[model samples]
Target chain A: MTTRTGPPAPEIRHVTVVGCGLIGTSVALALRAEGVRVTLADHDPRSLSEAVRMGAGLALAAGEPPADVVVIATPPSTVAAVLRDAQARGLGAVYTDVASTKGRILSSAELTGCDMSTYVPGHPMAGREVSGTGAARADLFAGRKWALCPGPATALLAALTVTELAALCGAQVCLLSPYAHDRAVAAVSHAPLVLSAALAARFAYTREGADVLALTGRGLYDVTRVAGSPPELWIDILEHNAEAVADMLEQVVDDLAAVGAALREADGSARWGVVADLLVRGNLGRELIVDAYARRAPAEGVELEAA
Target chain B: MTTRTGPPAPEIRHVTVVGCGLIGTSVALALRAEGVRVTLADHDPRSLSEAVRMGAGLALAAGEPPADVVVIATPPSTVAAVLRDAQARGLGAVYTDVASTKGRILSSAELTGCDMSTYVPGHPMAGREVSGTGAARADLFAGRKWALCPGPATALLAALTVTELAALCGAQVCLLSPYAHDRAVAAVSHAPLVLSAALAARFAYTREGADVLALTGRGLYDVTRVAGSPPELWIDILEHNAEAVADMLEQVVDDLAAVGAALREADGSARWGVVADLLVRGNLGRELIVDAYARRAPAEGVELEAA
Candidate 1:
């Protein structure tokens, strides 16, 4: 493994984002707002054309020169194959991706014999409940965490260039291993999605019908906000990070089962302590997350290495 | 069961709100904005003073005449006792409360021999992550549902006056039995709080420390948003509605265990459908909630009875 880390980020003038989904289009819009030349590409012609029409960037033309950085913004399952093809065609001088899961993609890239020297695996910790290019906004990544997992074969120059790309889009960069990225996101993102979905699914089985939802307050609405996300998109996300997501989810199940049993007890006085303990821990965890979000903006352009 | 529904709401000239926490303060503020005379009361001197300073209203003075409506805005566990005490003092011509759970409070009120004829149990489907008067706002209940659970003994005038109270706060009124209200909120509010708490508590066990929370996006943040609520308050809510909340929590655990088992399987292809099915159900449920919220405004002043 390479013990060396990259220097400060270099100035980035041109970027090529190879998908026109929400994250890809948002990146293009942010780069465009920074006066950076951004070339957009997508397998779906409609999405590419719509993104281009929205002033995101120009569509890639035949024989266009390689850009300084190429962002593989495709779905997790396709990232490896896309990286392989992009590298074969010399799409850019350096390569990175915006997939939420990293370990599997990294393994796939290696198995497919893609050049790791040019690839800096990345994931921007940002998204809305909605998806698609239509929901793209230039400020999507502003004040967000952009995680970079550079393997041993990754060149220092490639990692630095991708860091510059994240900075240009107004994001903070954090460095960690591929394993850590998958586990962290499973804790923070994937597992939460599953739990939200599980909670929301109960609503469908309610005998009281949809009118029963009238009693719902802001609390339930907030907890299930992401349950409205497209199922197909989340299916891919959950499948790719299944083991890590499953691990966290299993722990949550244990917590719920214990709390449920405590509530079901006839002698409720002693059992309330069990329920209260979990709620108190929840308060601490939630405070930590809020504090982390508040601390992010001031730390922009500063790279945080995983402990 | 009372088949006798109230007629059109009457004009509410003055309101006496007996608590000065977030919901009560917000109610006071909203009423004050509508030119209604508001007299506030709280056992906590600081909260009462804070509400008054925030222009919520005057403090309740001894020998003051009865107002048109009295709102018991205390915690769920104390609502019955407060209602009994307020009635003994002839606090108002009609009475209501803003507790989140209704069935147990209703039973407790009956057991305490409170004057049910002058009382209506109400729950406004509105709140914030933070508590106390400091977080109160006039628009807290605007465009939200206010549920009134009027038992057989509740006077038509009492229910109508409380409906007017809700109207002045810009809330839509819905009618359901105490049992239905408890069950609905268990499915929508109280149970979701437990699930969110269960999910968030896992963060406390992360080996990666608080910095790992930096990986969180808006999805996870939204899912855990209400997990930061005061634990003591939630403990009371869960206890008051224990049976209903436990029922829903158990159902959720079953769904989660099923999905978790599916994810843990060595052969993942067959089990993906299990996860995907729950996700699809979640989408439908979330859509129902969003649609319910959107439909709340134009249906203002129309009371929907539980079927």
Candidate 2:
């Protein structure tokens, strides 16, 4: 991780995490280790109890004092409702939600006529195939990009509080527009998921083609790993932000077609060049990603939005 | 690794590995560790000297005695020349070539009028994106599939010597026909490579697309990792086994087109189902691969064919 050069900030005193899923539980665990008083809440009693049992945080009891911040650790679909509830009850001085999609959550909050100034829409770009409180870890956010989107007229205190929370979790806080977040993820995360699903799906359905996948190796396994992601969750993610995903996937489709044509042509010279060009591009793309992720500091990289 | 149940076979006494690249250096190291006397050779004087310095084996002198076995570790295109040279000189008791493609090498051996009875064609399905002797590791072949394909008239001693080499290197000796070997690797290895190259190649060519790759994470990286393989080396492997690779890629092309069409349709219901179906299929294919690689035992799984 890149070293921090700034003066130290005040420690967070109280944090209330709503929804005890993977991200929520992990966030709670991270905060609790920093000596913050963390209160955990979830509508699902079993999940709530699991998070508490795993020492993510203490169970939120009735009539507790206002927390320093309320993190809406729910699915993107439910973030607006949860934020609205937290605002109505004055649950925290500042609020944030770690949803995968940013624009949708912000739009939902705007529709509900909630206090947008106190809310920061967030997305921690870290996940695993297995999920839920059971799979949560304190180090989940370390070195991962935690994209935060603030609406116009957002209170400075609200943004600072959320940014502080991200720093506490050891995340690289990247300032992104809700639209940019959707686009970036669509290009990197969402499109890969769709592409992997498509490839694996084809391998499964062929009559004479079962043997094709039967010859498995590290290459094939690595290529198809994302296809195993839970479809129940993915269906929600894809349908919610289908437009950007569709756009990115179209580009991928065009690229795939070019290679397909090259392979099909009898004279492979022209098509072979096309194939090689794409491979080189993929190499550059992968290098760009690794460099961006590995080095989050220095002048070449963008720092978290100035406080 | 899964434990072995059989009594230990006779150990290989003297091994001579030609080429001195990653696989060659690694084979020499694995043999040397097992107390077998090993000698190394390469067309390039530097690589040969480096492997010797790294203690992979002693460098072959002008008049060294014939080793019990001579392993041709050259690139696929040069395997035939190396094996023919070795056979003509009576360099060893038997001969083997560890080229990625089998059919071409076997055919080349036959065309050059090499003694098929003393030569066995082999491929160890293990590699890194990096190349040359510098990347070699003693345990490189451990738990990997070392495919050995002998001619119909291969001598018993030659086949046994190659099998012993695989066992000494801690590899699972998988006996395959040259045709089957080519076809299987095409399905699992070559097609995935082409697909990854196509995806990454697309990422490189687009003006705005480069930024998309900069945001990459585990999904894109894993899918595109193998695209960085040295183009010169891949060109030989692909051209030699182009027919099988082309055949496998045809299936991939069909799958990719179906998904592409599904993504293009405005009413995504039919197309969405197409994507989901491929995902489920990919899951099964992955499971089949893992099972095949992991459990190389029992009546259900295929084993090294008895001589």
Candidate 3:
């Protein structure tokens, strides 16, 4: 273990992005736009060629000069393997992975006995319906939140390097423990996925669903649009974040029971009040979350419009 | 009982829309656009005048004038009372309503002994986030579904008049039993309201919600957008459709429990598979729903270069 402590002299001049997929290409483009030297690498030659065509980076050879910073933007399941391989080959001075769930990545690193100090785990809360390097845009991360989950041995220099990387991408960098990060994401992101899917399934089984669809409105669109997300990707994410996600699902069930009871009593006022209370509280909570992450424009008006 | 059967002739030359709110004004405007002479009436004189200004009608009247059709677009709790007043005053030859819930309206009509032959209950499944006559758009119901729940002894002429009204508004007319209408809507529309609110409430109770908001994405926005709906109106709807809404909520709770169990198991493959299955089926179900409605232009792809 390198016993070197404190911040290292800022020497990150050339950055390398591996995997050349959606997030990887986006980071490369963002860094390149800021006049940073960027190199691209990917096992898929087609994706590497696509990233190059998109001006993400200059294609680098296997034994090329090492970059100052390296970013791995592979899928969550493959993140640890890529990091271990890259570090063993001495790809860069410091490295990080931009995966959605962090706890699993940290655990993988620990189990593999990778150099924790040189590796920072992060997630940039940005994406669109489309995927791949061809769909990447440098502005993808603008005004978005990029979370950094640094292990105990993470050097201050490595942390600063990652912060500067986020700044270059026009992102607001926030810090969180890996456990907290997983739990919070499970509440807002993973739970909603399952809920939306369940709603869709229920509609499919209903007899009048066809007739109902003829009258479908924006309300249904807003609620179930995410149900169209890639199933395989979601399955992987849920599996990795099962513990925290399950807890959130329990809370949702409890609330649903209250709604059911209010309906059974035919208490219109209570039923409406129950739903209204949840919506109002959600609006307020969402506002706070957006503000802290600086994800939205400053709240200028009465934010609670619906509930 | 006027046992008027078979296809009723189109005798509704002049139509009057009472309660100049969003639905009422939109209906009036749509009819007027079809070159039908429309008369506007409302308890609020200002609202009445505003409807006329928006070309909803030629005049604002205190009492029902000579007309063939009358549309009552008041709140659910007030539907019975409004119908009683309209019928007592002989508003028109054929009468209908534009309330969200239908069972209560039908019940109210029965209790008041409103002329069943002349009364045809209906609801236009169309609206926006904004409210009032000023927010009313002429094409609000264009290519949308309009459901009609007619009672026994209803004259064939009244049904034809209502169908013509739906066509004039560019909507597809559907016939359903009042119970079915309430039950279907509770599953699709009312339940979403409760679910959205519940999600918001859960976020509000979290200590890290503020932090979480900073990391929010489009996923949260799409899911909780409806949680901002008007509380008073929702309360009225939930109360009116309490039984149907309650049953749907129970089913949702059961689904949530099953999902929770899947998550708690050490092997989350089954749970993950369940979620994935739901999403896949939901995608197909939602697509069918959208297709059953009018088709909108697909999103155009724009070439996004690095910033």
Candidate 4:
């Protein structure tokens, strides 16, 4: 391995984004917007060609020199394999990923015996209600959190290069360990996905629920928006992050049980307190989320809590 | 009751809205936009005056002639009492409400022995992340579902007037029995709210979860947005609609249990299938919600399903 263990390069002059899905295409476009030479690659030639037609990037020739950075934005299951191939080919000076789960990807990289010094497992805290390369946008990462989990084996220059990539894409860079990243995403992302799914799934088979689905205001609409993602894609995510997600989901299941008990009560005050407690806690979480989302736009004057 | 019973009116021109909260002020502003004579009232003089200054309406005088309609946009617990008092004082030709629950409010009117012919219980499928009169906007109900649950005692004239009001406010009017309305809202709106809160609450007390909360992407953010609603307000809603909300929550709790069971499995494919099944169902539900939300703007070309 070429030891470029010094300060970060000033800029990522040439980059290659593998797997031309939503995240890959978006990253390529973002990097391209910053006047970087971006190259697109995917197993599906048509997919990569379409991304190129959209001006995302040109296809990297087989004989092209190693890029300054390589972003593997493929499915979680294939991340380690793709990274190994890229490393075998000496594809870039630095390598990173945009998978939702990091623990599994990192472990897979280890098991596959890839060059670890160049790999920094990352996940962008951003997405839309829709997916696919067709839904990609250059500004997808703008002002969103982009977690960078640099392993002990990671070289300082490689970590710095990924940091530069995030900044150029207008993302707030966050440092997290692979294990820590997996657990955090499990609690807030993975488990919440299942929670939203289960709730929305209830309406799918229940006619009474469907009859009034239209009557639901923005509240239900917002709560279930993420449930629209392609099922097979989520299956891939959950399969890799199952254990951590299940742990977080187990706790939420307990909370639901408590809510059920409270709702069954005929006593108004008892039921009111249970609902209020959970809701108050939820208000705290929501505040944390909304504030973190805007970075600089903190909300104010929110004083309504349970009496 | 006055002998005013016939087909739906062409339009409702004169209206007064009580409560001076988010829903009340929004209704007043929407009515004003439709060239209707709108009056505002509330127990809090400062609130009503603030709404007036925002041009929501002029405050209704103690001795002014009754408007064509009086909209009671109050908390669920007090809707019946306010409606009864308004009916006793001959406040308007018809009365309606914008409470979230229907069964309890209807029961309260029965308990108070109010004149019910001029009353139509309505629940607008509209809200925002923020609330109160300060956050009121005239387009709050635009293109949203507005359910009108008229009892047998409801006069045709009264129902027609309310329909006109909903139409003028750019809402699509729906009809249901008060009992049916309560159950429907409980299934689609109320239960989903608790589901969001329960999922969010898990993250609240979990220190590990908090560390990663900022790292989460849009999936968690959308699922928990509704959990930010004022706790006291939600407590009132949950109390009034506890039975129905609880029933729906019971089903969701069971679904969560299923997910947890499937997640505990060691086999990746087995767990993957379960996640896929639930996520597929979720996709169906999400489509239903999205289609119903935008009247003429149905999404298309979404074909990715579980493998």
Each model's TM-score for chain A is 0.95, 0.90, 0.85, 0.90
RMSD of each: 3.7, 4.2, 7.7, 6.8
Model 3 - which docking category? Answer: acceptable
Which pairs of residues clash in candidate 3, taking residues 3 or more apart in a chain or in different chains?
A268-B239, A279-B197, A282-B200, A289-B213, A289-B214, A290-B213, A293-B214, A306-B228, A306-B229, A307-B228
For model 4, what is the error of residue A301's alpha carbon versus the real structure, in angstroms, after optimal superposition?
A: 31
Best by DockQ: 1
Candidate 3 local lDDT, B1-307, one digit each (tens): 2344455537557898888999999999898888889988888888999998898996645664657888999878888888888888887888899888898888878888888888899888888755788989889987677788887768777888887788788776678778878887886788876777667667676666666665677777777767666666777777788888888778777777877887788773445666666667777766665565444222222111110
What clash pairs does model 2 have?
A200-B278, A200-B282, A201-B277, A201-B278, A201-B279, A202-B278, A204-B281, A278-B201, A282-B200
Docking class of 2: acceptable
TM-score of each: 0.92, 0.87, 0.86, 0.89
Q: Write the per-residue lDDT of candidate 3 for residues A1-307, one digit (tens) a residue.
A: 2243445436557898988988999999999998889999998999999999988889977678778788999888888988998899999988988887999889998799789999989888788656787989998888777789999899878877887787688776778889988987887688887777766666776666776564467777777767766677777778788889889889888878876776676433444666556556756654554454443542221111110
List ranges where model 4 is wrong by over 4 Å: A1-11, A205-210, A296-307, B1-13, B203-210, B296-307
lDDT string, candidate 2, B1-307, tens digits? 4544454443578889998999999999999999999988887999999999998988887778888899999989898888888888878888898888899888888999888998989988788888988999998877777788888989867777788888788776777788878887877787677767665554664566644444456777777778777776776677677777766666665765665566556854665787666666767765565555454322222246432
Which stretches of candidate 2 lie above 4 Å from their native place?
A1-11, A199-217, A267-271, A296-302, A305-307, B1-11, B202-215, B253-272, B288-307
Clashing pairs in 4: none
Which model is ahead, 2 or 4, in terms of DockQ? 4
Please identify model 1 stretches exceeding 4 Å from their true place.
Answer: A1-13, A205-207, A298-306, B1-11, B205-207, B298-306
Residues B1-307 of candidate 1 have per-residue lDDT tens digits of 2244456568899999999999999999999999999999999999999999999999999999999999999999999999999999999999999998898899999999999999999999999989998999999989888999999899887887888899899887889888888888888888898888888888775666576787777777788888999999998998888889889998888988888888788865778899899999999878777776666663434456654
Question: Which candidate has the highest TM-score of all?
Answer: 1
Q: Please provide, for model 4 over B22-139, each residue's C-alpha lDDT reduced to its tens digit, 9 standing for 90 to 100.
A: 8999999998988998888899998899999999989898898988999999899889999999998898989999999888898899889888899999887888768889999998
DockQ-based ranking: 1, 4, 2, 3
